[model samples]
Target chain A: MDMRRLVGRNFARIRREQGLTQEQVEERSGLSQQYLSGLERGQRNPTVVTLFEVAQALGVTPVDLIQPDNVKMPRKS
Target chain B: MDMRRLVGRNFARIRREQGLTQEQVEERSGLSQQYLSGLERGQRNPTVVTLFEVAQALGVTPVDLIQPDNVKMPRKS
Candidate 1:
């Protein structure tokens, strides 16, 4: 899957897990609901700072938003 | 410290640890050296896609770039 889509999917999943709506996230992150919706749909590319703010609003680290659940660390030789 | 500065510091540290310079990373990541310098200085905010590409060029995951080394995951209750 595309990295952008992966990040979006992770964001949506985390947000849902927190039981927060897009509107609620917007209020906390100071981002527009339209922007958040676009992000959730993988139609938008957010800056690192924006991601930090969104993660903060969702009570997660930015890494959580970007890392797909299935990614495994490569084994050291 | 500000999150942006923290990210920039981490990026510079990791790049140096990999023994790669901005010019070298630029050649691999297809990002300009000036932009990379700005990013490392916390003067530029990169999109998540850009971060993903940078991480790929560095042989690391995007999460590695964003997560501070000292950050500890909260213990499960």
Candidate 2:
């Protein structure tokens, strides 16, 4: 999967897990609802600061928003 | 520490660990040296795509460039 789509999916998953509406996240993150929607749709490329702010609002680490859902565990040496 | 500074510090540390110079990263990532310097100084907020590109150039995961230096381990329940 593309990195943007991966980030979008992870972000949406985390936000839903937190029971946050787009309106609520917009209020908390100071990002517009349209922008948030676009981000969730994988149409926006957010700045790192924006990612941090949104992750903070969602009560998750920034890395969580970008990690792929199907990451494989490291193989034994 | 600020998130930007943490990212900058981690990025610089990783780049140095890989024995890569800004010029090398620039050539690989197609980002200007001036911008890379600003990022290293914590003065620029890179986009997610930019972060991915730079991380790829540095041979690191995007999350590794943003993790703080002093993370405490979670206590056992």
Q: Model 2 Cα RMSD, Å?
A: 4.7
Scored against the true structure, residue A32 in model 2 reaches a CA lDDT of 94
lDDT of 2 at A31: 92
Q: State residue A45's C-alpha deviation in candidate 1, in Å.
A: 0.7
Worst 10 residues of 1 chain B by lDDT: B1-10
lDDT of 2 at A39: 91
DockQ of 1: 0.61
Provide per-model DockQ scores.
Answer: 0.61, 0.61
Count the clashes in each prediction: 0, 0
Rate residue A56 of model 2 by lDDT.
91
- lDDT tens readout by residue for model 1, B1-77: 36667668878988999999999999999999999999899887888888888888788887888888676889999
lDDT minimum window of 10 residues, candidate 2 chain B: B1-10
Instruction: Compose the digit string of candidate 2's lDDT tens values, residues B1-77.
Output: 36678778888899999999999999999999899998999988888888888899998888888777788779899
Pairs that collide, model 2: none
For every model shown, what is its TM-score relative to the native structure? Answer: 0.86, 0.88
